[model samples]
Target chain A: MEKETHQNIESIIEAGKMNELRKLLIGLSHEELERLQKLLNDPHEFSNEISSLLPYAIRKMVERGEISVDSLLPFVEESMHKSIQKNPQKLADILFPVMGPAIRKAVSEDLKRMIASINASLESGFSFRSLKWRLQAFTSRRSYAEIVMANSYLYHISNVFLIHKDSGILLHEASAPESKALEADLIASMLTAIRDFVQDSFSNAEKGTLDEIQFGSLKILIEQGPYAVLAVVAEGQPPADYRVTLMETIEAIHFNLGLELEKFDGDTEYFKLADKFLQQCLIKQKKEKKQKAPYQLIFLLLLLIAGVGYFVLINYENKANFKRFITELEATPGYHISSSRMSFNKIYLKGLVDPLAEPVEEIMKRFQKIEPGTLQASFEGYLSTEPEILQRRAGLLLSPPEGVEMKIENNRLIISGTAAADWEQNLELKIAAIAGITGFDISGLNKKITDLQWIIPSIERHRFLFDINVVKLDSLQQIQFDSLVQAAVFLDAYNQLYSRNMAIYVRSYTNRNGNVAANERVATARAEGFITLLENAGVKKALLKSQVLFAEDLRETVSLRTVHFSVFDNKPISR
Target chain B: MIKKKIAMLGAFAVGKTSLVQQYVHSIFSDKYQTTIGVKIDQKQITVADQDITLMLWDLYGDDDFMKMKPTYLIGASGYILVADGTRSETIEVALQLQEMAAATTNNAPFLLIINKSDLSETWEIAPETILRMQQKGWIVLLTSAKKNLMVEEAFQKLASLMLNPY
Candidate 1:
């Protein structure tokens, strides 16, 4: 009979007929129903066929509105036992659809009410215990009923309860058992809600208020929450203060819901006050914006008026001062005046001085007085004569121990002197610019003073053997003589009859055609004769001395005159 | 043509921004502006026959924030680790950045910029500190944004380091 009844029950379930299965079960004797219930409850004896029919039966009960907290309790307990006997995972899957939504709804409603009550209590100063009682009463009815109906519903439901508790909703003692089953789940869900709230509050909260709240605990939740919550919170405030606060709140909710409630109260009030403060700030910002507009306009208008006034005053003062300056300038001699405002004054004075016209130095001095502390002027203007300026500019070129002599003759400046330094070329350029000069005759200057010591040594060596002549010529003639004698003396000193191949010639001719005739032949002959005399003095044939001849116009003559000198070794005596 | 990567490293509260501002904008701000993440700026300079574009990255100095992976150090050719001359701890931070750079990448050339030299009496990091850094093979320089001292030279030295790696 039991086999037949089990077969019938299986058939009824297979046909998707829960009503038939109930009818079939009711028709059985009490003993048979007991036996079948036991068999169904025992998963080892209950075939997979029967277990499969269990979900259909429970779904039917739920659809028929017959699966109340009490009504579904037996089936849930039996199913749990059967699931444990067979496969716990399969049982969860089989039970999920029939009980998942209802449990989730019950828990979500319970948590929502709890959160609302907590938030209201915080805002309205309602007693936390009273709010806790009300939330417990509100949540327990559905939570207990669902827990009795489906033990698998405990996971999601527990999470909802804990989240509600974490949100400051107190849990009733009666619902605590179901909540304990959901410890991990509740902590996860609560952490998620807390993290979301803290993050949102942080991002949108009043700027200064967030600093007062602790976010350190929230990171604990981020580390310990469900995968979903962990993932989201990880992105939000990984280890930030908000995450820290969330973590602490979750821990408090788990270990002590009362403390969690207290913290929630504090956080909620803070958020509220921050919101009000932010609104007030927005209003103040609007006021400030409105107030700034007119002040800015007034400021701009004042600036414009000041600018116009300053320009007008500056122009008027400049005009009045220019008239006075023009009157004073007109009194000065050799002054040329030009002013744009003079036409307005109707004072057209020819040859009047231009007030702006002055030496650069005077202009710079006046500018310094007008604008004190101005940088030094870079203008290079001077009022001295060109020659003086040139001399000053050439100051760097003057070598030590050099003197210059200047003479003016026939509107031509003649500079005649010997310069003992190498910089005489540079000095000539300076002295050439003397005033009233048509041209400068600098040819009379000698760059070096002839050294007589060189001649003295040669004279000492050749004094007893030959007559050596030394002649000094005019400046122009001396230059020619120096050039000519330099090569001859160099050759003779090194190659000629050491001391005896020497003769000195000295002659000064008058400046006339007759003088040229008188001296030219002699100068030539003396040069040639010196060479011959060196040969006669037993000097080597290849080493002979010669003479240097200079030509100049004597003081009384307009024609060229000649002077000759014979150098032996370094000296010349009268020949 | 290798782009010059210039990293700006400094302690928690030094005027690295002031130095950068003085160099980049010729301006200074007395207020401290906290940085959260790395900021990037670019400047072009001509050095030794090459037109180098300096890619300057300004990194956060807060030690706690440094926990995040240092993605900013990648591809950096050179570094300018700035420290407050008035704070010795900042020199320590600069040295830390030097070690971080070495550990993260191969030993990249770097310049140790001791900022705020104008406040000489207030300087907590002594000249000996700079000499010590130099002894450790760091290119050290002293600068002052307030007086605009050696600010350009600091940047130029780091830029040159990119071309002639250490």
Candidate 2:
């Protein structure tokens, strides 16, 4: 090491090893260098090269959180301050372009917040105020939604902005008449810088972006996209769904002005139609706060007055009607009010409501729609639940028949009262209709309404032997005519006593010795001859009814060929 | 089958209606009627073994009184600019109309048709004026609706140019 330590001795390039060193180095080839130099000289190509990585660089910067838009906001404010102090006349011209957009941004946010509030109110249950608004909205000719906005929405958008995403330059603007005075360019730059700074700083750990900023009551809402961002400032929270509208605007700008936007050099004259997109943001302002406010309040107040009036009236009507129902129920017979109280829609009557007294359930039903399964009838009665026993007992105790006596003995009804006639006559019709009526004995009744009084209710058959189908009566048969006369008199007495029209039914049967028509004629003639004899014996023609009955056995058997006599009342009397 | 829309653009009362009537119906009407809104009519013809349906949008002529709407020329494959040879100003109007049509049709193939050639004695348009347009690479034709001369050929020329752009 101490023999030759020449520090300046160059062994690599001194021996014509420059080519070897150049080959080992990482320098570009000559042709490639020339091309690169040319590319560097061209400004368009240089910018184009950087532009390719602009999006990625911007994203990386945003993710790092090392930069923020606040850093550049001072520059914007300084520039405007300088203009105001140094070049006052140029201030208007400098600020003219930014005014519309600046105000529009604020208004857009205000309008958005109002919309969000309205939606929130609707999503929640209706308060008194909200319900009033809903009713007003229904009555108005306008749509319910429009009326709701008119009532609940207090903020509006006076202007809107469309700014370039990369350069933060105002592309186009829309504004109401009142927002014509503002500096939109400076605001756009400040907003962009703020967005950038916020995105780059504290937001580095995550991909989340700043969505809002607050200053006093004024607020700003930021909506982000891949290529652009929209900032809105307002006094309240913006509508959550306004993002869809803003997104659509961004999409349209991307589609229609995409090519232009990429190569844009701060010229916005071509984007004249940007107002069309921003007009959506410029919702008509709520006219004079006091004026619109009073009108809505008055409407709500009037609606509330009417609603309260209706509710009071209905409550009064229901109370009055319920009182009347209670009074009527107490007055009704068979209803005993041991304890009666009305709890809401139910009427609890603990009194003894006699089941037999006009039927408690039926009494409740008489009043339509008043009682629907609300009647609870508990009656004090005999141990038996049978309807017959209940009916009999109730009838005897409530409205006992006049001058009538009843005894249910041996499971057979025994009655001595004169009104027992009425009860006995209804035995086959109504009293037996009860479920548990075993049987009845009217033999002890005084009036004898149950007496077998109609012609003894028996068929009195009188047979006469006819010789060779001749209908003439022989001497022996003529001897029986007195009995026939006596039978007619007896039937007449039965009719008078029973208070009915009892007729003598004489049915004559003919032998089957000839044609049916001829035999019927023969039998009819014989019946006529017998009637003449009965008429001479004092029987009325209306009381005598005759008919010819045909039978083949009558032709062979002498006993079978006969005239049958039976007495019957045309109208049987129950009394 | 292919649908090719064509426009009839011209000056006010410049025989545009007459030319369309002649080309579409092959019939002549002596009535000098002014068209109002665009009158749309269609006709089918065979060209190069393909059926071509021609939707003829006869746009109302452009004038100081009634300027035609250019939206009517949208989706047009070709157009015919009709001018009355008797009026030289109508030729200028035809050029203005051609500009409007070209804007909407995306410069579709077109023909400049000078109508009313049958009234040659009363002609006001100069021959040099038409020659200058021809030199500027314009497809020009002289048609007479009254005589029914070269009217169909004028429309066919534009149609063929559109179908076979060269």
Candidate 3:
């Protein structure tokens, strides 16, 4: 019966019908068939061949929802224990070549569930050793020693993988390496393939205007086992020569593969080593994940905090900008008609004011005083039309006298009317009060009449005196009029005495001498009087300063006969 | 505050150290000291009401450094590539450094510092050559550590460029 069952199983396998094989096993006796089935399933259960099948089956089961990850885990654990008991060595042997595919399949099949399970178990403080044991059971025979060693290798490889993966993803989104490289040739080939693919895609996408394609690749060789390659293609073309040079990269990788494996051994042994490595990786990944979880969470928390901070900062900046706008508006010069309608930070003002007026300094100063930094004003009123109203108001404020007429047109103030002398100041003030007035025309204005000649005469006299003393003289010679008067006092006294004597002589000559007779006597008397005056003034041997000679000297100088002859005829007529 | 990371790269024995020493220490060293890996120093400065931290990296003088490991050039905000004023060959190195920096960082702000300007009589590189290089998108500045000419200015300008980044 066992032979028939074996033959039937062999036929089903030959026909490539696994379902039939399973169905045929049910027909044999339970004890014998169970033994045969266990034997038949042992290779698939413990070997690397099962590595391929397991992923496929798990994927299908997951897709169909026939087996949840929680339900599948126990079976995986049992299989791992059974394989290890059956042949720990064989299970270890299959791991190296198949580790790449196995890991890839595992990740692809149920990345979300695996991540969740790992995270959940990690939170519960389940040790990495426990996780490694589980992974080893799913993939191979679970030996404690193999699992421990495998955990360490996996830790190193996963670290490398994560670092390279981050770099690759940052550089290019679509092409990232799948594994780590044990061989230099694999690294080279992976780099070249990535470079070429990125260059082609970038050139095609950018229409050939790009300069360089930035990308990264992952190449992992399970020494003496299967090779896994991952390439990331960037969106731009690199240099053409670089692409050309990359074609030989695959050949180089192949060469490096030989060198890498030579450092190890045959394929089966290599896979066994890799299997141990995978086990180690699983444990290490679990441990590292547990260790890094807090950090990742912290990083996420920090990012969230930063995001909130940025948002608040942006809001503050916007508010500040709004406040600044309002302040600028308030600082401008204008009548604020809608000041109450706006907030302190968003005040608005409107009114008639000169747009091109001078010294914006005045406007700024006024605005500063009104609201400090909170107010800004701008003039939007019609400067050309409002000058008349402004002028009238200014006239009223200045208290102009009743008759003075003032008008403002186009920023020009016009005053054309007569005003009392007392109203002159008031008129000037009225014109000055008009806003935006560039100039004032008061051509027709007149002042009240008042007498001022009496006052002017004295002022003129003083001015004449001042001019004589100071204006006509050089700066160095100019002196006070009183000083000059004091210095000339004696000369004036002497002149007065001389004038009196001469006047007496003249009167005596006119009275005493009739006609010609009296003239001769008067001349003699004048000469005598001048001499007497000089003598009285303390003069000794005095002579008249004038060119006219005295009477005595004149008689002496002239001959007596000629004088008598002239006097006989003249005296006869005068007497 | 954003810290600007800048690098001083050049060929062997181009007085990069002298320039950095003059600006940082205000002293001139006649002796030549070759750098090994990378040396880092920092300075605080202000521009337009913003405080900025300038992180200056003085790389080694070996020409083969770029070829050996390009990773050292990553994360640079700006670069100052120095060349010897007396040697025209150094200018070639400067050009190569520019290319490498552009390739590494996608054209970050870069300036070319031509050192040893105190020896103008011995200079074989003409101003025209520097101008030509500048026309090709390289900023060239003449400097002399001994004279303290344009050394601080080079750093200030590079820091400003890094801060603005546009």
Model 2 in CAPRI terms: which quality? incorrect
Query: What is the per-residue lDDT of model 1 for residues B47-158, given as tens digits with 9 covering 90 to 100?
Result: 7887765656666674655542334564456778888888888887777677878766467778888888888889898668778778988788889888999998888877
Clash tally, candidates in order: 30, 18, 25
**Cα misplacement distance, residue B15 of candidate 2 (Å):** 1.1
- Per-candidate TM-score, chain A: 0.17, 0.28, 0.21
- Please list the residue runs of candidate 2 whose C-alpha ends up more than 4 Å from where it truly belongs after superposition: A1-575
Error of 2 at B9 (Å): 0.9
Tell me the DockQ of each model, to 2 decimals: 0.00, 0.00, 0.01
Q: TM-score per candidate, in order?
A: 0.23, 0.25, 0.24
Best by TM-score: 2
**Per-model C-alpha lDDT, please?**
0.50, 0.66, 0.51
TM-score of candidate 3 against the unseen true structure = 0.24
Candidate fnat values, all: 0.00, 0.00, 0.00
- How well is each residue in A389-450 modelled by candidate 2, as lDDT tens digits? 54465355424356556666544455555542434455444445444456655555544332
Per-residue lDDT tens digits for candidate 3, residues B12-84, read 8898878878887788988888876655555666766667656566677856643413444555667899999
